[model samples]
Target: MTCSRMQSVVIPRHFDYRVLKCKVSSISVWNHLSVHRSLAMNVRRLEVLDERAAGSGMGTGDQTKEMVPGGISSTETDLEDTDDELGMHEKHEQYLLDALSKMSHLESFAWSCNHSPISIDLLWPMLLKCHTLREVEINDNLVFSPVTNDESEGDSPNVAVAHELRAVALKSNKHVYGSAKHPDFTRVKGMLNSCPNLESLNIAYTQPRSLPHAHLSADDLFLFGRWPNLTSLTLTNLRCSPSTGLDAASSFLFAHLNLEILHLDMSPGTATWYNKLVFPPNCLPRLRELKAHRDLVSSLLACPSDAPRPLEIIKGVRLTQATDLQQSADAFFFNLRRHGVNVKRVELTSWHEMEDIRRLIESTPKLTWLDLGKKGNGNHHDRLGGSGASSSGAAAKSSSSSSSSHFSVVNANEWAILLSAAPELTTFHGVKFFYEVSLQAQASIANAANLPLYANGSTGNSNSGTGPAPGATAHVNLNLMNLSMTDRSRIRKNDETASMLAWKCTKLRRVDHWEDGGGKVVVIIRDCGDGKEKDKVAPRWEIRRVKQ
Candidate 1:
């Protein structure tokens, strides 16, 4: 690449680096990465996961590196040929340290292991070298320090603490259903002590479960000093310590005045436990996004905040009881209206009727993305993008009116008519897009766009509204529709949907098509004509799959 090209090369802040054992003369990922020294200097986040990288694992063979003195190597060698991996691990650690030391702009560093938890002694040199590093994440059973016998107090080694670091995420070695048996308090405390400038803390399981039972507790949190900079907090799988545990946690949350985002997915009877959850006066003044179990959503938002904190996202838990889809949606809309919250993105788990869905849209008109909760949900999506007989005239309804007994099968034209009120909407989910091109559907879309419909894109009389709108264009902004039915998500025929709505919704950029074995295919609606040829300018459609 040329110097100009190299200068303009955009390096992603988040980088996932994996070390693989290759047979090409011990050439490592580091060897290739080191060539672009500029890339290393600008890295903000990095992950190292390999068979024997750093503290991931140290082999247990009798072949120790021939020592000069105090088991120190005068000259470091690569680990490809060494089975005496303890001494061999030093070389890998040296390679890691050398690379980390050069990342002056690095902010976040993540490390993982494939097996058991190990001592993080190997990470000390790395952490010490990264001056601007603000975050550290480890998936290994990476312990802080060994525990002692004393019940009240115990002796744990004085580990190096990065006062400049702002975030630390610790995940279990295992990622199955029992992801969080929960690490010990002493170990958590040791970690807390190591990174005292705590701002954002995320200790949650990596998977989904009905309930998560953890040994970690609220009392353990009180062991550390209050972080004044703490803004975002996520606690997924933990039981209340006891009678006073949840109370202490409540107090802890209330005390943090700067908190903005909070996800309290407390488990093992998650929802019912937080029914009585309370917030102190004027607490969470800057709070914006709140996610928790559905049962706890109402109670959580019931306690009014002194400030007018406009929440942009509220993700209540997935609904296990399908019977209350209507009641549940009504309650959610009530909160949005009562709290005066205007959200941009919504993920409605389970399902709800069309009327309930309409109420939600009216409540949050600024919605840019809406997930109708996935298909195979309580109310299944139309495999044929079902437009029932009642929904046939759905396109004729006013943008502000409710449906006329339409049960299912909302076509592209109906969606265009319904979502026309929210011009900012782009990515829509939950509903299937089974809209096949037809005269009625085309006419409806054209009406929604404030343009006259045309038959077969041919210019005709401008007297009737159904005739071509002489030089008019679509006013619609809807684009990037996502269907929940994976089997029927793909839009066929060079996007017959895009072509039909082209006169009405000109800005429709891309739609998602998911084939079970294939990755995501994006429909690109590009304007290939020049401004000089305004009359000739038309949208060109292209399809490409996003690499997984």
Candidate 2:
């Protein structure tokens, strides 16, 4: 009898298979399909009882055989436990390993492992084998053994790792750069010259101490300048003096013109060095984005002032500190407008008071996105009281620190002024803690400027119009993540300042405020149509509360 015929011999579902296996311990089929020492031991026991019933002439063979889902016979069911199936299982595991190995191409593999020590030798072979390796992020107190070449006795990790990765991000280390015993920038330069396709480099440390200017010979540039495709470069807190290998890197741009992004987050003291030097014409004509955190905006802009075109294609700009706020503001905007660049977006890290904010907004008329907020307290008391308190000698001496700390708050108000200036602005993101007087006055100013306001809602759901007016979407976008105000009781309804805020921002879509227990309450005002549904209908604004 075949196994298929046995299925037609109806049996109880709860029949114990182990009892029958115990009775027929001497069976050959039971020995072949042993139940012991296997992961599927219980499955094997069921098969043994099944075979015993078939052997006992449960039914006739061949005609009434059962066909499995894969159309495999009982003969093939036995093949499932054979060596061929094991081979297929092994092949599947290898296929998975190959897929995981290729993931290093798009991502930084070094950062992927958070709490495991990476095997350098194991990885070196895989990296050498894998063609898709692009970025290697070895940070977070990682201790790696020095890389050794095949044929060198005194080989100090022959810098072969550079040939594999396009970009290397190294951070949080004891040494100034990546290596513990001081990194020779020449070794890195040599590695870069060897790799035909290397693009970006990121390194940040406690100090900027590597490579003496005297040691960086002219041969360095001759070797390094071979890379015509090199574009983006970033160096943070690197002790690169005027004489050091800085010229070797800069010379590449002067000779060939394919650089795009340059991020220099250098030490505060070394920032002023760039202002003194000048570059050749068309050195960096392809340059579009620049991020300089320490230097005064005026000095950095002075570097590319004489170029055939002064960064007309430039899109993004970030400045940490601006010297002589009013003067710096004027110079920065004038250069962009002069070039007809039309700076669409801007982020101001430091600006204090309503006057500075107003000046910036009025100057940059085409700004669409702005991230302007307070860094220091503005001497509002000084402005409100007519500068008389600071005019006194004794008061000036006692309030020097307080006065400086007070400037950041005033700087934050400058953002509101800029918003008023650029009525075309669509998105304003950042912490806003300006005084009520300035906010109200600026709101009125913005309203008079013809800036249309839309509440935070889906354009499809908007009853005001079919959708947002073409250029009006950029004006206001509030961050509603983890709101702090939940209940109307927590907000002082009768307070003079609170009342002013409520009335001033009549065009507001959302309002977030603080409540008890550090929770949030969000008030969403939607534009539901009034009783009349005319084209020019004044949409009703209904405020709904969202409790924490």
Candidate 3:
């Protein structure tokens, strides 16, 4: 194709000039945009994320130099190489600003490169000038605090606010989550003032516990006026003063009845701290996805049985230990069984037992994704002995049950049984699952699954019988960090067992083996045959899309 034709076809209306490497030729979007100056007018969304310098190759006769106005051959522009990096950066910043001027029709803009010489404050007027712009996001990547309102405003004339903006997200440096240091609140307030009717807002601000700010509390989240269009709110790394009481955030939630998605990260305190903050029941009728602390899960799921929540995904982070879950475990699960009936995905960093997993699968029949937590140690024996086991027979039964139910790690047969309970589950993360380690156990599970045994007593599948199509592929990513080589070797992925699992749980696609020390290993079921011999060698791509 001709260069002009290629530009017309390849360039998208939504452009992301984000690069992780400093070697994107000129290390700026303008040099690349210079290649297609006409295409800039068509851009609707532009994201310049993690922008960096081009390093040593700047003065060379590179493609970027040829595409951009001032090349190495141009006598008008004098730029140094690695010896004078600052001069090159200054030249590129000018080029970047020139490119931004061309994108007059841009509707969405995001700037996340804190290291760039360009200040986000400088970009505000340029972006707000775009009459079509509606959404904006800024991520702080700098070492210092953000510019204050007065500092940001400087001597620039009063620019008209973007009343048409529908979404705004101002994020702080994410590395420090539980700290007082946050992005400049004054600048954030000024930005919020510009857009009053936002449909979505994400502001992560935390302050010292002593001098509590209402911005972290119920003062309409510091908005100039109510935002009736707000449907999604993500507030993280927040610590409201205890003196402010539990109603600080909940009161805000009560007012926003139209909210569909909410992700709140409060101070990681005790269960009592979590339990004290009640999730006002019979509210947020439109809530679809939720992520909050674990102790408050029961209350969040405490919506009326008749008015069950339509939550498709629910994620919880445990504040305390396993003993917290030991309280009314059955009833806690019963609530999940009720309100979570419509749920398709469950991710809990809270403690879980075999019975807990079993109760979960049996409850959420529509479940396709399940993530058990890594917080609890296996103390099943202790729980059994202390729960008042009277007779030896009961003890023996509890002993057998604990082996499958209580162990932090479980065997393949036990996993197969648990999987059998939820046939629809395709993706599973968390917990240690080992297959092909115990031959006797494998044989027993194979027998129970009614899998056909060959002459050698091997259960390797030959037919696709109502299974994954021929040459089908699945992707798994598991990280097994900080495990002894012996334990790691034991978890060696056996493809045959993975196929057996695929046959047992026919829809199974991906299994993520996540270890506590932040390791992952993914196992795929591949090359499943159609049981036909005529075209054994021909390759065919059979793709299937599962509904989420």
What is the lDDT, from 0 to 100, of the residue 89 in candidate 2? 43
**Judged by lDDT relative to the true structure, which candidate is superior, 1 or 3?**
3
The candidates, ranked best first by lDDT, are: 3, 1, 2
What does the lDDT come to for candidate 1?
0.51
Best by lDDT: 3
Q: Count the backbone clashes (under 3 Å) in each candidate.
A: 2, 31, 9
| lDDT per residue as tens, model 2, 328-424 | 4566656544542445555555444445545555556665655543234323232221111121221121221222223212222233333445655
List runs of model 1 lying over 4 Å from the truth. Answer: 1-46, 52-107, 121-130, 142-160, 173-182, 206-219, 222-225, 316-329, 376-410, 413-423, 434-511, 514-548
Provide the lDDT at 499 for model 1: 52
Clashes of 1: 2
Please write out the lDDT profile of model 3 over residues 1-548, one tens digit for every residue.
36976675554432332211222124344644544566566666665544342333453433212222222232223322445767666766666666667777777876656455555566676777777788888765331254656775583556567778888887655333222344334445556666767889887654435434423332335333357778998876554544444565566666787888988766554335566665666677788988876546667787553466668888864423356456745556777777777888888665435666677778789889877654354343322211121322211222112233232333444576677778788777664443212333233323433423211122233343432233321111111223233322333334334545655675666664322222434444444345464223221111123332
Q: Taking the tens digit of each residue's C-alpha lDDT, what string does model 1 give over 294-387? A: 6556655555776666667776545343664647545756776676455776676544345555666677767776666643345433321334
lDDT of all predictions: 0.51, 0.37, 0.53
Q: Flag the better candidate by TM-score, 2 or 3.
A: 3
Instruction: Answer with 1 or 2, whichever has the higher TM-score.
Output: 1
Q: After superposition, how far is residue 435 of candidate 2 from its true place, in Å?
A: 12
